[model samples]
Target: MKKVLIISSTRNSNLDLSKDIKNYLMDKDELETEVIALEDFELPLYTPTLEEQFKSTESFPKNISKIKDLICSSDVMIWCSPEYNGGISPIVTNTIAWISRATDDWKEGFKDKHCLICTSSGGNGKNFIKGFEMQLKYLGSNVFDRSLIKTKAKNIEEFEFTSVLTDFYKNIFSE
Candidate 1:
């Protein structure tokens, strides 16, 4: 079975969106899915000095290790996050920073992984999509060409949301 990890960057609307997406993904019997809220994890701010300290520490933090393991093992990741001031949320960025520093391969968790970006934002969310796409691509992930955007006046249609996921799933299996 394929291990699919669905991550939400916040506990608010983003989490709701993640859960909704998880349900749609679960409808695929062949996939093994797990959902996580980024706020639930204990992650420290990442820096070169922090990385040095962690590398020299006697033991790695359990929470970071656990989260890293999840990311490493997953075949696909669906990132559901909010856009904050025309960019990706800080929580998601923090998670990525910590994971990159903690992992031996640095980009192992994202390299070649299929990532589907979804957003529940108050704004247009186009900037978040563009920003995250660049970041994910830099991390070596195969980001989905299109993203699902949900906002105040407009919400993603059921068919459109599921169709995005369906196409992403097919893309993964095709590779």
Candidate 2:
């Protein structure tokens, strides 16, 4: 079975959205899905000095290892975050920074993995989706072309959500 990791950058609406996606994928015979909220893991802000300190000790924080292991083991990742000031949230960026520094290969957690980006934002969220797509691609992920956007003013309808996920699943797992 393929491991599918759903990462939510917040404990709020985006986490709820991640759970909803996990629920949708739970019954799929070929997939084993798990959800994680970044808020649940307390990580210090990433900086060159902090990273160097950890590396000097020949280790990273336990939470960093836990998240990195999850990403490295997963075949597919569905990322859910809110747009903050027309860009990706700080937690998402910080998490990636730590993961990159913790791994021998910077892209170890993301390379060749299938990624589907989703957002539950107060804003339109287009900028966040587009920016994150580029970043994921840079890390060597096969990012889905379409994003699932759920803004506070306009929520995602059931049909649209299901259709996008169904298409993404087929495209990723087809024989």
Candidate 3:
């Protein structure tokens, strides 16, 4: 069975959208899926001082290591995040920063992993998509070019995105 991790960065109604996507992904019998919310991971703001301190401690916070291990173990990743201030949310970036530092090879958590990005945002969320894709590519992840976007006016079911998501997953797993 393929292990898939779905990460959601939103804390509001957008979280419902993430759950919906998770349900859809779980419907696939061959995939074992786990959903993680960024809010649940209490990552402190990253700074050079903290980085040095953490290195000296020689042990990362348990949540950081746990999330890093999940990323490392997953075959594919699906991200559902909201755009904030015309960019990716700070929570998402913070999680990435911590996970990158927690592991010896920063890219080890993402390299060669198939990724699918989706969003439910008040705004169009195009900037979030572009910004995250750039980061994922830099991390050497195989991010899908297509994505699902649901604006405030549409609900997940109304958006009718399951087919695209299914196809994306099928294509990636077939590789």
Pick the TM-score winner: 2
Which portions of model 3 show Cα errors greater than 4 Å? Answer: 156-159
Q: Candidate 3: which pairs clash? A: none
lDDT of 1 at 119: 91
Task: Give me candidate 3's TM-score against the actual structure.
Answer: 0.93
lDDT of 1 at 144: 90
lDDT (10s digit) by residue, model 3, range 1-175: 7888888886665667667777877778778888888898888898879889878987657888888899899988989899899999999899899888888899999999899888989877999999999999999999998888888886556445877787787777677
For candidate 1, report its TM-score.
Answer: 0.94
Q: What C-alpha lDDT values do all the predictions have?
A: 0.88, 0.93, 0.85
Once fitted onto the true fold, the runs of candidate 1 whose alpha carbons sit more than 4 angstroms away are none
Better of 2 and 3 by TM-score: 2
User: What's the true lDDT of residue 89 in model 3?
Assistant: 93
Ranking by lDDT: 2, 1, 3
